[model samples]
Target: MAKIAINGLGRIGRSILRLLTTTEAGEGFEIVALNDIARPELCAYLLKHDSVFGLFPKAVSHDDSGLTIDGTRYPLTDNPDLSQIDLSGVDLVLECTGKSNSREFATRGLRAGASRVLISGPCPTADQTVVLGANDEMLGDQQVISCASCTTNALAPLARAIDTAFGLVSAHMTTIHCYTGSQPTVDAPRGDLVRSRAAALSMVPTTTSAGRLTDLVLPDLAGRIFATSVRVPTASVSAIDMSFQAQSAVSEKQINKMLAALPAPIFGTTTEPLVSSDLRGRPESIVMALPETHVTKSATMARVFGWYDNEWGFSNRMIDLARRMTSM
Candidate 1:
């Protein structure tokens, strides 16, 4: 079994462990340690009671020594700096700290002695960036990796599928995303004016890295795709509203049929008029909303819609990358 350490306990971090400890995906991995700046008690409580995912299915408890899940004890600590930790036995470090774009932070686990580092979100400086079906073939001996972001994970596959079938000329993507921890429950100060407002109160127009990151995965589409985001009031799940210019013309039926044939656990298709909440725990990268596929009269231009459980789907991709890196 490969030894693994997690460097954060936020939504993404906890979700990663939740999948690892509870599913067969974690069969050949061991949780060597957990690191978070939050107190051990709060970390344990958060693990026990997740606001969006509900309580973990296994027993969760923590003491000064560490965290115990499903009766297995793993060392847990409140360490602000990973360089100070001794992760000598850890084979891989899952860096869920959203700020890992900083090469210094992404490499901290390596400095601490871990064999590899897999960041949860986008990191331009990472040795490689893997987006499952879109670009996982590029994964090899890279020591520092960015799984890309949740949005990128959901968008890249569909974008790739469209490009593969219809030939992407250019694309514009708009994601109606759920609010995240970066936004406050109430109006407050944040990095910018739009995000500083109450996250749950109204739709806040923001930006997405997928526009640029998608180019990284599908280089042929470089400088051809752009994306934007609107943070909505929901607690989970997000929507992808995309319009693409394809070299080949396709009708609405043709587009849905094309997406319907895409494989699962990565991409899926459904005709149900499902709301965002219905997609809460879905593991697929993106579930194409068949009924929402709209083709222009010219057929050369089209609009598509899909839903994604940003946390769960992205977390699963993280596990996929982690398993590969650990050679599990």
Candidate 2:
């Protein structure tokens, strides 16, 4: 069987393993090795009990030998120098540590001996950036690739689908996002005062690269799409509040129909009054809150809500892009 390696056993790295080992979507790839700055036991502990996903429904243990989940042991390494870690048979390395978002670090991942590298976050200097179902056809013979940010994964598909169904004239999006591992629990230095506040206590407004990166994925909406983000006191799912001005007028019914008609896996529509936590384990890239769909009185502008389990869905997308890269 083909093999893979996880360079950082962070939220994304662990989620990738879960997608490959725990679920029905558990794919053909086997994670043969792991690299992280933390100890294997700590990594195992976090993997076994995710605050966001709940307890992993599988036997989990770790030792100097390796980290085992569901009775399958994967060799674990904690070398601070990633290139020093062996990835001999690793077809691809998932660069999820979030520490290395630069070309220099991405190249270091490739140096670990994998045929290719798939970054879980944006790496503009990466050979190519892709969001599956949107612009994956643009994937070429690139050694290092990025899946972009979670916000891009959640927004790009809707952009592509809406742009295809009805011409997108201009769009302004605000991602009502959840706090990630990056934010500190209490007020501390985070390179900015706004983001330095307590993560669980307040909503912190911040910038997002989703629009610029989305433009890279689908050039048609290059300068027309704009986005911002606000980190709320949540741990699992995130949402995008988008107002898209179409080329022509359209009703809320038409907008809802367009969303409902989207491909189920990439874009989903739900009529239920679901909150953020309700979407905690959803695998779809973006789920339209059907009842919340709104259109301007003039019908030229439509407002919609999209929810996504940032970590879970993005991890799934990593698997999808990884499978595609390995196939090539």
Q: Candidate 2 lDDT, tens digit per residue, 127-229?
A: 8889987897889889989899889998998998888988999999999999987789999998878998999999999988898899999997899899999
Q: How many backbone clashes does candidate 2 have?
A: 0
What's the lDDT for residue 105 in model 2?
86
State candidate 2's TM-score: 0.97
| Candidate 1 lDDT, 3-118, residue by residue in tens | 99999999999998888888877888889889999998999898889889997899988898699898899899888899899999789999997888688989999999999999
Clashes of each: 0, 0
Q: State each model's CA lDDT, in order.
A: 0.90, 0.87
Quote the lDDT for 155 in model 2.
93
Cα lDDT for residue 57, candidate 1: 92
lDDT of 1 at 219: 89
